[model samples]
Target: MLVWERPEPRNRPVPAPLSRDRIVRAAIRLADADGLDAVSLRKVATALDVRPMRLYGYIDSKEELLDLMVDAAYAEILPVGDDWREVLRSLAESVRHTAHEHEWLADLLGGRPQLGPHALASGERVMAALGELGVDAVMPVTAAVNAYVIGAVRREIAERRAERTTGMDEKRWQASLGPYLRRTIATGRFPALATVVRDAAHLDADDTFRIGLDFLLDGIGARVSK
Candidate 1:
């Protein structure tokens, strides 16, 4: 009897090759490239060279994928340390950077009180920093910090949306504003507004962010302290 050599077993296929982490990362990259509206299970699966059903093995739906993506993005926010003031300052700046880098992130983080795990973890870090400042009640400090971050992010998003809709570059905007603004300034009806406009020809986003951060921090330091 001729012994027939059995064919070598085909390498076991990687079952459910799509993973939660991989899916989230792909979705994030897709969002980064094409904006958040571009993120979908089908899009991610296509990007990963797999069927959309395969994504279900790891993520239940696009909503879950969004939650995961948000958590992953929030992870970039570094934890706070011993110095409460410094920690607050650093955290605020880090958030500003994150918001600017991921313009869609602010819209993803809406007014919902229930935060994703990563966001909650960042909140805890902020709370821990507040604790170091001897804050007895958790609510007030948490409320303050949350309000500050949300407000700043909202403002940034609004400005970005305005820029997108207007289609005018900053230089064009300034040049157009020059003549009209001068006329507006000459009229005494808007004295306060004119003064601010004259003082700052063009409002810079970074300067606005810094000013808002400082104002919020000052308020928190003065009011939250024992």
Candidate 2:
């Protein structure tokens, strides 16, 4: 059973009155500072000034700890409303920003379904905004936007890590590719590719996310009107 579905211990004789919230918060702090692998039951306990075994009263294992972390982070990702387009747009942008803020978020998001309260709340906000579409359509619409958010976040963060590793941002990376691109495009074997190489303005990640999000939202808007 999931840790949230179980009762928290009420009368543990720990030094501090530890709640699940406190434990989860401490764990997230360790993760944010040193990355996810740096977080452990011992590390979280040390942060809380308690024994590692004390955490067992609130959470059972590392997997459960990750679940709590993901759900809690979802609190920052809840959406705002305007039209459905605006609502989902806000959601997508918020999630992207949240994942960037907590870079480890992109890793845990793919592992399990986020059924915790805050995760459910984030979904509810988007789906309710699209409620005009009726029950059947609302779910798929929300799912499509969420799919884009998840995929975009992962790719954005992956590139971010790569940049960090090599100390090269997009422009420098593209500059490195320039020689090979020039040699390949000279043959006139790939006219479409050559034009993009020559003419396309290299957009940064933020602009790419915005433009891609528009594609999904515009398609959904067409369906909503029909």
Candidate 3:
């Protein structure tokens, strides 16, 4: 199912009738149906009812197709406010939304960023927004924010997939762990764990994401001010 180890997209000397957009779209559909791992030139060709080698006329490799797919996903993300902080937050949330919609996007995002036109434009927009904050080292600041957002989205997606596969919500999982947790608490062995469970309200994904975003933005602000 892994595309990386699969055969290369058959190369062709002459231009095939298939357009790059059509191939990328087909690959995206394949990913949607069976995940990014299931996407391959061979499979995409089958989906398009063309020979695997024919796809090479448009796409060089699965890696390029994946990069295109990532950019295509990026193309769907909307740009936000002109303010630096607001822009960063909006962009991150937009990416998170896209990843949530296409689970395969999360996997591809963790790989190299596609410097394709749409992806580069997104980066440029983020950097331009940071200009509002008088950030001289725009590239580094943007990279840091990008890294933070990517890491956050990746964790979010993986955890969501885990929950789906297990068919258990957080409440159910916590309830199942209740006995063991209570037993540990009863022994008074871990005061911190006991105190947290007693005092802390459970945070859902959105709440946790907001809290984490605020914390990260606080740090970024401090850096910007310095």
Clashes of each: 0, 0, 0
Error of 1 at 54 (Å): 1.3
* Model 1 C-alpha lDDT per residue in residues 8-126, reported as the tens digit of each score: 22333665364566888899889887788999889999999988877765666677677777778888887666667777877777776787777777877654444666777887877
Better of 2 and 3 by TM-score: 2
User: What's the candidate order when arranged by decreasing lDDT?
Assistant: 2, 3, 1
Candidates' C-alpha lDDT: 0.73, 0.87, 0.80
lDDT of 3 by residue, 68-167 (tens): 7888898977668868888888887898888888889978775764677787788878878888666666777667766877788888888777788998
lDDT of 2 at 1: 75
| TM-score of candidate 2 against the unseen true structure | 0.92
TM-scores of the candidates are 0.82, 0.92, 0.86
lDDT (Cα, tens digit) per residue for candidate 2, span 158-213 = 99889989999988988999889889899899999999978999787889889999
Of 1 and 2, the candidate ranking higher by TM-score: 2
What candidate 3 gets wrong by more than 4 Å, as runs, is 1-17
Which candidate ranks first by TM-score, i.e. highest?
A: 2
In model 1, where do residues sit more than 4 Å from their true spots? 1-12, 113-117, 133-136, 161-167, 200-203
lDDT for 76 (candidate 2): 97
